[model samples]
Target: MATDHDIPSPCPSLRDRKKAATRAAILDHAERLFEERGYDQVTGAEIADAANISVKTLFVYFRSKEDLAFADTWLIDAVVDTLSRRPSGTSHAQAVGEVLNQALRTLNPDSGGLDAFHRGFGESEALRSRLLRMWADYEDAIATVLAREASLPAPDPAIRLAATQLIGIIRSCTSDEVREYVSGFPGEETDALRGWIRQAVEQVDNGLTRFLDRTSQSPGI
Candidate 1:
């Protein structure tokens, strides 16, 4: 008789795999189309048609065209998940820096879809606004994870401030100005960008500690 520990995990069912494949097809085709044309020039129906799925089915996966356009924004979700799973003794800065370094390693400077996505933000005010809102949500998610790790209550002021500062460092590293400079460059430029990210993370780690110490030492009365 097999014990519970001996039991193997079940794989996804055929139907579920097909659903995943379809979703990927939609996103891949949508990105290609958005890159070829502009975000505003592409319509949900067009993307659906290109993906060989009906518009209704496309909506089933994504709530709006903008959602489909920004599908890869899950980088924020990945960051929170990574931070949540860091080793127990890892410092906050180390956890965040490791997660960011992993992301940097995966960056493909030659990816046309990435360039187009960045261009999409530049071309549309609405997209920029949506991206700002998404960043706020990302910061909140990071704060929640940090609070849990520190055993603090949700919305803990210190944890929130730390999360905001870390997110700001990440944003600065990948801002439009930086992207424009490095997007079309060779691997050497990408390496330089990675170096800058490492430096920024180090600065935040040291700067935050000093600031906290100063605040604690100041007279409250």
Candidate 2:
């Protein structure tokens, strides 16, 4: 009784296709629902009915509401991929600097999808804590890339501490507070945000240079 466009394929691959379709449906419903009702407020049962999927099916893609809470894992994977493809001889700090620049630039509130995500995040505390934890993962991922590039004997505590410091600059220096400045003065008159970013980058650069200098200094003590 359905039209040609309405009829789904009868093949076995159609089952797999339908599974993927259902998964996407669940994610769409979850994202919107979490944004609407607090991430903790929305239940899997509510999402299942909303997305027109069985609760079991929703579990197949996501373990918990927290899974849906921070659904932009793909963005972090993209960051890792970008570092993987960096030119051959890049330093750990420079590679992170470039990646941070790209990542920060991608986050302009004028940009719609992620901007809306920012709004959603700004409202959720549980989500905010998890998001804060993700910054460490982001830095560690970059540090691993740098370690492999540098052929370190043990890329542990040192690379991790260094990466954490670099990421700290980006995270702390350019914060949600920057958005206030951006909105208040959207014109060229306000250099506050840009100045903050420059200062953070320079501090990281200087710290990195100092660390390398200490490493290279003749040990005559």
Backbone Cα, N, C clashes tallied per candidate: 0, 0
Alpha carbon deviation, residue 161, candidate 1 (Å): 0.7
Instruction: Give every collision pair in model 2.
Output: none
| Residues 51-101 of candidate 2: C-alpha lDDT, one tens digit per residue | 987888788788766667666666557656765776755644455556545
Q: Residue-wise lDDT of candidate 1 within 117-205, one digit each (tens)?
A: 35443367677777787778879988888777656577556667788887876676657676766655666665666666777788788
Poorest 10 consecutive residues of model 2 by lDDT? 109-118
Model 1's TM-score against the true structure:
0.79
Regions more than 4 Å wrong, model 1:
1-4, 87-90, 112-122, 180-187, 210-221
